[model samples]
Target chain A: MADDIAGRGDPIKTLQLMWGRIEAPKRGPKSKLAVADLVRAAVRLADEEGIDAVSTRRVAEAVGISPMSFYTHIPDKAVLLDLMLDAVARPADGSEEAQAFRPEDWRANVAFVAREYRAFYLRHPWVLQVATHRPVLGPNTMRAYDYFLAAFDGLNLSEVEMDLSVTMVANYVHGAVRDVARARMVKELTGMSDDEWWHAIAPFLETVDFSPYPVASRIGPVVGELYGLGDPDRAFEFGLECLLDGLAVMVERKGGRR
Target chain B: MADDIAGRGDPIKTLQLMWGRIEAPKRGPKSKLAVADLVRAAVRLADEEGIDAVSTRRVAEAVGISPMSFYTHIPDKAVLLDLMLDAVARPADGSEEAQAFRPEDWRANVAFVAREYRAFYLRHPWVLQVATHRPVLGPNTMRAYDYFLAAFDGLNLSEVEMDLSVTMVANYVHGAVRDVARARMVKELTGMSDDEWWHAIAPFLETVDFSPYPVASRIGPVVGELYGLGDPDRAFEFGLECLLDGLAVMVERKGGRR
Candidate 1:
């Protein structure tokens, strides 16, 4: 699982495995544990017990296969993670039709995709642990990126701005959802409510000379009131609107949309 | 550090300790250790090792103090971490002047502060481990929020828009910087550069049908060329400009800036 990069086997070969571009192992016995079965088991393990609980041995055991057989399909845990990420990257119902981008309603299309993307992260917080430094772009990963790009099909954006807008929208959703998902995890782990925690710290906040922070003082509570202070949903929707609004301005700035 | 919500000591008292609203421990003998000294030691430990290495026992050992004495100043590792975060939250030179907001140059002020904020996260990635469910809002954190709000002092936004805009900008920066910082950490730990990884996988990517993913195929390599696909700094700057552009649109939509 902790194999060094060079020792982790050929990434290109791994990509072939992930994308089903290569045939199944002919050397192995015709076992019932197909690659999809293994990936499903791993995803379930990660969802139930968090990312740390997922190792090649544990996943193989869960699927009633030997570790050697698992390795015959997946060289290491890293590849297993990539497969698992790709498995969950699509809509939960496994319907490609639901994910089709609507060029006519681009704003709504972006919002819909962004919301679904946020839900994916919330469901599998462990995916964020895998640094995207070398993103393993499988079929689903490519589709996801393509779907995001399709939202700006006729917006007349330079390739650079189109890419930038997609990235900005994605980053905003990721950042907003990350905070919300993380907060939920913390609350569950600690068995504490936000209200209880804030009530405890309210007295100390009062002691501070907020006069110096005039804008934050006047608007902080109001902002806090607009949505529950730690509510990611409200923040996500609000941020998404601002991002889409900004993308529209960019389109306008680039000499009107086609 | 895994202290339960109620089991943890008074948050008000901890805030007082963080803000120096309380005095140094009178119960302990005259010692060289101040709270800041202990925090610095802990920060160094977290930096050298990861956040998991930071414990009251380890920090006390580094500072040559008994665990009991360590508890005298910090009730537990959670409070100690809050202090450590606050300590690094200030400008690296420990100068308040550097963090001062220039109300006249709102856009520049925001850009400057966002850059500084990104630098801080890169320096102390461990801060991300501490969930914001119960944000430890010390004087510096509040000041940071206040500084962000100050950028929109007369932007003619509703209180909600003002707050949402600030959050949008912040989340964009956070999302962008997270990718960059996490990539750097992965490279350091794995001894693998992204270029090396991509070069290794480029062959397999070519085998995939690009025709199906028109926009991604058209612009993906272009973006990959512009800044190395995972380069967070380039992405951060681009996203920041988009967010500010969006905020400006909101100001204009709301009847222009004051």
Candidate 2:
């Protein structure tokens, strides 16, 4: 899961697969499945099951190939993971997400980029589980980074601030997606909505004294009644606005924009 | 590891346990271990290993008891997990973290609360792996939430906004912690500092063309040089300031705080 650090594999071999510079297969009766086919199957398996299910052997089985032959196609799970990460980095061509590079209206462009990541992550939720902090050095990953930075091209900030700005947006989005995803997973796993689950525990909770925690006691129920732990969109939008406002304030301080 | 949802176990029994109201054990020769002892063992195991290693049998083995006998101490892994969560929730008494009930400077209080969560999560990083969206209906968890809400007692937000304000801070902290923690884990697992690892891979990355990603091509290396994946504190602080700034703007808009 989170332990699966990207760029941990043999850099040359993994980079070869990521950049589509893979050498020819060993001479034998070759399998029909290409590297892309394995990655596709792995992604499907991850989306259906979870990141832990994306084992090399399991992926090979899904593609109707023997594990032995699959080894020839890809070296190991690490390389396959890098491939999966970089592959998903690209939005479908001509999609609104693919065009997230408007130099004008930098805030709107930044917001759009943030939303695109949220959408893509929710679609391939497993990607959120992988730690891409090691930096997935691939074409599409690079393209996505470049594209995201393009949104800030119109802004007057140092290159480092621009990079840090992207990190902030990415961090906020990651947290927001996790909040929503956790709620969905708990509901699915327990077959109980947060409300129903709370209802079941209310009687027991009533036996305990809540006087010691006046604020949590008062605010806890309000948060529950409001968001039901399942919906954090309101909270997310609130935070996003605050973050952007803060960024704009900084720009103004620099005598750049007001 | 992220799949372990809190409050998924039997709620009444779990809630009973969380409130320290466990029923008497079934008729048997009692083993000399309280539930606290078992939870401590489980927490230690998780810290040394990972969350997945905290199975009932494994914890039982760690605490020097048969798996069958351990069942008497706790019903199952689910209950054990809930207990471990709440047990870790409490900071050591009289520590700066344990005393996070500042109502004076709201922003500093919020920042302090954020820092405490980050510190504790780093110490017990496995907690980050467990999805606590269902909300561990335990005293310590409740106390933590309530205490956190106290930091915003001076904020002029609506009830729902108050709840969301806390959520925003929590989400930002969560994201920040994950960033720092991911860096720490990658360094430990690869046994290579990010700089060392990047130096090894730099030769191969050079072979890949970067003409398509002009912005990334410019900023990516600067980011690497500034703060390798192993270091994200500067970026985190930058984002936190922006978040607070953004929040201040909203309060001003509400005609509450200047």
Candidate 3:
């Protein structure tokens, strides 16, 4: 992400790798490994050991290839990171999950879009840690961007409104994803569930007086026990619904097709 | 974070430290530094460096104290992390910023809450990197939580609805904060603005055919140029407006207090 953001490496080459315009020569090659093999391996390393674990050397070893050979498919760690994320960002078409995301009404489609992206992010939790400001202009990344943009199709949003709507929904989902990922990470790292962790800490908390914070004193446990770790799913639903309603109001105020 | 979640430390001690109930005895041979001094130093380290830069040993050096004495103020790294976040979570009550956040109508108040948090998160970018699922139960943390929950007061929401409302708002704001932070971090780390970075890569993007993504083709450059590395302030306003509208719809739907 740093390398890409810094304008290092060949942008054309990164785009080429992204669009699959260039590929390793198949004939008379020492190995027939595709560029995707490296990206997939890198993704696996990230899923297991975090994004920091993803390196050309590590991925090459995982793919049973040499460092020099790995570079034949992926340009650099930055380009490799770009490809890995685009692979995750690519719409999961033809999968069982994709089937469930079939669009209905505009509102249902909007909800589906949020749900799909949330699931997509969860599947590759480390991807959220990557740079989000400058979305990689890869083919798969473009396809994912199109998918989100089309969610509000025929909804009467102006050009700018359409773009901002997509951005806000994505921001909301990513926020939710971060919360869930935090919970999952804590559990994975500490080898304890939120339930057990809270239970373990309950003894100490029991001694603290809560007379001052009326709202927290009353609602804290109800929320804490129910949502020990943040409940992103529930929060997403609530937020998305409100967001959709808010959009409807704006559209109505603007009054139909412009 | 790992230690706190795993329930390894004395929560009472952490609470005491967080609430300012415990302080180094000042009458003896020890220096005049207080727990706030250590926390303030840690906050500074986290702001300049990342959160990982903060540790008992490092903070002790920053505060001109010994690690043993630092331990006297903080129990462990996890407790230190909790205290650090709680400090960030502490509202800028009398500061000029808080003066602007004076309560108004419910909708205005909701917007204020989101904006306040966005500003708060931006002030301490590293704080967002810490685990967020289980918020530290310190006085400042609870105080912040109370302030959030109170945004919807007298809106006729049930207890559960009121709770969910606050959760969704924080999620949305944090979402916005992440986008802004990503842009800021990229610029700070690379010594190049997103505009400069994009200009460097524009030549490669110019050759691509964006026809398939007509929505992206037309709107991409507009948003990309205007937003550069994600315009969270604009995105937050749009999202918050939609969220407020949506909440109004729900409130109207429920019809009255239970």
Candidate 4:
């Protein structure tokens, strides 16, 4: 356990050895494998086959290395998943938008961040599941959170209130994405298109007496029709707008505190 | 199937016969195996062994019937799941509160419904996963939805706004309960007492620099502390208050648009 430094055969210093491998300079004039390279490969695998398919052996093979070789950089599969999440969550520069932030432009800023975050999740649905659980304190996640906090800085909210607001938004985004992703997975696995399945289940909807739930029942059809627009981005945006609208009212009532 | 129904069965009706057997009544003089019975059994199985342990066969056996017998009332495992969901989602009696509704009473009413709904989910965590996937049109589900929608009926929100508001509240309840359930499962499977695990993870949390994500980082400890409170009632109340506080502003702004 004492001789493997970046695959040189050290055991006792496993974590340190892995960190060294991750930080090692590129060996070739062009490129050799790096932690980032491995993370990218893992993300690609997850995108194609779902997160359940990802493993040290699978990622190593994708990177043209032996499974044991992966130990040089990542301590375990959990660490690899963390790194992959971080790689995908790299802070959105949205510099153009960030620079545009102004006291009067708070709503726009909120909308922009929400849209960008939704886009990020849309591009990597697996991230939603992973990030919601076992949230790794990674650089990318921090960056994303930083942008959100900064957006609300001018609202003069109490620490607790601010925390609650951020939690609400984050959970909303996470939950919405999870819903959209599951819907997509169901579509892929069942081979029954969303509308086709809805039609099959329509009889159930039609026979149910919703007088007891007039609001939901009345709007059920419209919501059902919007089910899998085959695009999460739009659904997310719609939900976000409504959430922000609700938040906007809160902001005003709190005397513009933030 | 005809023999069971008419004393002579047709070959083409074998499949139907099998389904009828699956749906046959359970034991006891009062027992008339219905979809409700299977759903109740399925819920019990889920609560005892987790959702993965629930299947048509398991449910049938639990009710003292052949595996094939479950098909009669439920048609398929998916429908069994749907039935279980509806059974668990039976409406909360908000009539007492609804009769006393006032502008200021809205928050408490919403909180009550949310708490009841959360309690329902926590009692049967498996329902959280299913509830998040699709729209609910079952009688029980509708009754629950109507209770929520009725809370805000006189508050002056537009039809669309009212729908969106309900969705947001439902999303929050579902997400929070799901998180708690997952945490509970982890604690059970890992065999680590919550305190022991938290102490072990504390050092890592302290060593991690979360300055970049001031809000999430600062609030991480609070979130972690609240992690396994497992009382869906408490979490639901907390989130519901925040949401209602947010919605109160919306109500004020709309100037009683109803």
Candidate 5:
């Protein structure tokens, strides 16, 4: 259920559409509308409201186009979603900026990529709901993937190790971002801040015999206080440091980083 | 929309019910159902048909009770979900089993816990959908949390570091499982294995310019081949090793483990 893109229409066709390989229909009256325009409209809707709020009718209404015209540009919600992801997947930073990093500083380059990817997911968490396994390879998505792959240059990792290493960083950042984002959503949905909610449950918690959990009992308060400070970013920062440290150790053990 | 236990009725009341601190209704015409029964039914339904399949009416029907009677035991779906998580969150391994590890073997203990937690998520993926942020602290959940916290005994980490270290492992495992699970679901949904899908796209992928992405172009084949072997678990294993390695390094840097 997590990453099923079943309704996204045909993967090949969606990829073609995403890459802008297919030209606009010549038979229809030349409309000013473009696929990018339709994708932008849908992404805006998903950003403000969740992805469920995005519909063909709703997007068409938002963009001041007829549903039929919208269909010509993108056939269904699935393809539109692929386009939305591709749109956001565009490397927000310039290629020149990426290239400016020294080739030897692979770790820094990786951290840069990780930070960017985390920010991208935070901006459009609906991206998390879509299937990342068999993603429709658009230009932006491909460029982004390529950018990440480039970060491992001369790291001395085996081919498989390279992929898996990038993936580990990605998985950690994704989990961290999702935790932060989900915690925020919980706050909104429960109509209570983390402090308010913890305060509400504190009395009940006090009754529990936490004596058995010396570590959790001692540290739980500190952890809760950190979260209560309204800065979810600290967790991410800590995680990132640990991850990079681990990566260095991995590289060293695997015959040293170039 | 990730962590919202809204309308779970009251947090304190729900906790009491979950902890079995409150007695089952003595006044319900001697119905055989207990709250645990309803929760088990819900968990079974979720396991078989996914979380969305778990509705109040459906659970009530599954338990052979009137929906009204079910409501007396659990007021709403949110609270029911809390109970469901608590039910699954129970420490499957005995603490005696957990304590069998030597105190100095914290790394092994942490790895043991990570693998177990990963297995739990794979079995009950719906557990991923619930609001983990403001978890309804039932006894089972607390036990599980405490079990995780205890893994760092004598690691010399501050309370905050211990909490974050545990969290880092949890996040990495959660993310890894989601990826593996999502990949399997995508395979089923697309009716094409990852290799078959890549083969389908390879011809088109070849048409695209690869000059700009030397690293992706070089290693993409290897990455695809690994997925082709039908072993998604490799990434998780690699990640776990790296995380533990990283944790060891972190502990050493911060005044050593044990």
Candidate 6:
């Protein structure tokens, strides 16, 4: 044991040394660890084995450390999970660098954010579970929200109205992407693609009498295609355009009110 | 055993009898059991004990029947779950009775439906899990879709556009309500109301510098309020209006195109 300790670094001694450094009466060198590294590994695990595979120990193992060692950096598994969610959702930088932007130019900005957000969700399907519900806010999460809010700064509206507008748009994108991801996952797992799944289920759709409910039958085919195509990004773009146009009306109405 | 069987009416026998009657081996009295009754019982179980508490045996016990008897009317738990989802999402019956209403009049109708849908989800939070992810095409599900699609009639958009429009609106409401319900449940279980929870975590939120990011900080307040407010119905209404306004723009644009 002494030779092992002398020849190779002592596991406990090394841990103690690291712990000493971290606890060192002063913050320096940053322990060669970061929240981003942990989040990145968690995302990788989620992508490889699905969201269910993500656990503090697994993430710690991926980072080559004891599970207990993670607690020094993060509070708990929930914190790690929340951080992972934010990391995946962090918006693309330089969105604002495109200077030709305007506040009333809701269409372009909304579409841009929607596409970016959809891409984020697609890359990390597990994030949908975290995003769709109330979340424990993390650094990355706050940043993404700030970016969205900043995009809407020039639009004429009350603080509350701006808040509501941003919420609606974000929720819409989150919902649409989630549905798309679910369909995709099902296709991947069942070997029955969206089109095949729809074909199999089409008979059931037809057998049901929808005359008393005419609209569903009228639009069922189209809704079917939208979902069946399995392109969340397209859906996000389409819906974002519709929502922004709606907001434009509000902007006009606000202008009139003022 | 005999006494227990007498008291319980032979679980398998009861189910087989109900099944045989419904199937009509020859021409027997149609099974007295109704799908509506089963769905109601299931909903009650979900509401009172949460969705996880719902099961075939529990539902059967609630209805004072054998678990096996349920299969006569519903194929399995999944079918029962689907039926419950449809029941909760039942549409307003008299929507089409107003023949004189114009396309713009459709907004109020859609809003009304949106409100009802939100209430349905609030009343049965468990339904959100199944409804959002699963592709169960039950009668009521079709009927609800038909009603929403009908609201867009005479708008002059292609079938595909109309379908996407309706989906955008429906999905927004569904996703919004799901988020609200989850927050409410978490609050209830944790014994910390939404505001209390936020205040408790405020330090964490403040320390989490998401400045370089925009979406989280900009939208955090709204998301915070959404959770803080005991009722999410108002938020749902606000979002529905935004979505409708967006669709209205599309309708106007299409008319201009024509």
Lowest summed lDDT window (length 10), candidate 1 chain A = A1-10
| DockQ, each predicted model | 0.43, 0.59, 0.41, 0.17, 0.49, 0.24
Interface Cα RMSD per model, in Å? 4.8, 2.7, 4.4, 12.1, 3.3, 14.2
Q: Sorted by DockQ, highest first, which candidate order results?
A: 2, 5, 1, 3, 6, 4
Estimate TM-scores for all models.
0.84, 0.92, 0.83, 0.69, 0.87, 0.71
lDDT of 1 at B15: 84
Whole-model Cα lDDT of every candidate shown, in order: 0.72, 0.75, 0.73, 0.60, 0.74, 0.61
Clashes of 5: 0
Q: Which stretches of candidate 4 lie over 4 Å from their true place?
A: A1-39, A52-84, A92-100, A129-133, A188-191, A203-258, B1-37, B55-79, B91-104, B131-136, B191-195, B205-242, B253-258
TM-score of chain B of each: 0.81, 0.89, 0.82, 0.70, 0.84, 0.70
Best by the DockQ measure: 2
What TM-score does the A-chain of candidate 4 achieve?
0.72
- Return the DockQ of model 4: 0.17
Worst 10 residues of 1 chain B by lDDT: B1-10
Q: lDDT for model 6, please.
A: 0.61
B1-258: candidate 1 lDDT, tens digit per residue: 211222256577678877888765578477677888899998997776656578788889999988778987778766777787788776567454456665555667768777877888898876655543367678777877887777777767778877877787788777777667666766775677788887878777777788878889888888788767645666788778777766666677787542
- Report how closely model 5 matches the true complex, as a DockQ value: 0.49
Which is the leading candidate under TM-score? 2
Q: Report, for candidate 2, the interface RMSD.
A: 2.7
- Model 2's lDDT to the true fold? 0.75
- For residue B221, model 4's alpha carbon misses the true position, in angstroms, by 7.6
Displacement of residue B207 (Cα, Å) in model 6 is 4.8
* Clash count per candidate: 0, 1, 0, 20, 0, 18
TM-score of candidate 3 against the unseen true structure: 0.83
lDDT tens digits, residues B1-258, model 4? 000001112211222222233344477464467656777788888777766578678889999889997775555555555556666675444534345445556766667666766677777765544422344345566667777776667777765566667766766776667666665665564555546645655654565566656766665556556653234445445455656656766777887632
Model 2 misses residue A158 by how many Å? 0.4
- Give the alpha carbon lDDT tens digit for every residue of B121-154 in model 6: 7877766555222454555666667666776777
Question: What clash pairs does model 5 have?
Answer: none
